[model samples]
Target: SQQGEEDPQALSIQEGENATMNCSYKTSINNLQWYRQNSGRGLVHLILIRSNEREKHSGRLRVTLDTSKKSSSLLITASRAADTASYFCATDDIYNQGGKLIFGQGTELSVKP
Candidate 1:
């Protein structure tokens, strides 16, 4: 079963603007992570927030998690053309032995220069 589901299926913005994306999950997770992918390449981990943590930040990326609501949000500040990519949220199944990450549908972002 799919765990994460992202909102705003696609986003378009100008360089320097802020971009925000959201994800909602269905089950209890050990940890939630956000990743970015450019074109058809591999995903690069942006940030990971544990179930005990509410918020986390790294560079221009900020993430907030609400376990009570089973949701998470990602914010990208000072967006640039290079920020154009597909953003996905993943959740680690608490019941899985291998700690597999179930990915979201993803939000495709287009930052125009």
Candidate 2:
């Protein structure tokens, strides 16, 4: 079962704009984490908000979680071209052995200068 699915597989915007992405999951989770991947590099942890938490902010990023609906949202305020990268959502499912993380296909964000 898929844990997360991000809307708008791809997005293009100018620098200094806001980007929003949504994710929906099938099962309950302990925590949901968002990550940013640059080109071909590994995923870098952006933020982790627990299921009990409603929202979290890190630098220019804001994330919201609604466990009732099994969904989450990510907001990037004042985006920059440097922020251009693929964003993924991962869920920490308690049922899996060793707690595997299921990632979304990802939203490819392109921030133009």
lDDT of each: 0.94, 0.91
Model 1 regions lying over 4 Å from their true place: none
Clashing pairs in 1: none
Q: Candidate 2, residues 13-39: lDDT per residue as tens digits?
A: 989899998888888788899999999
Residues 28-69 of candidate 1 have per-residue lDDT tens digits of 888999999999899998999999999999999999999999
The TM-score of candidate 2 is 0.94
Q: Each candidate: RMSD to true structure?
A: 1.1, 1.4
Which candidate achieves the best lDDT against the true structure? 1
What is the alpha-carbon lDDT of model 1 when measured against the actual structure?
Answer: 0.94
Instruction: Name the lDDT of candidate 2.
Output: 0.91
RMSD of 2: 1.4
lDDT minimum window of 10 residues, candidate 2 = 91-100
Flag regions of model 2 displaced more than 4 Å.
Answer: none
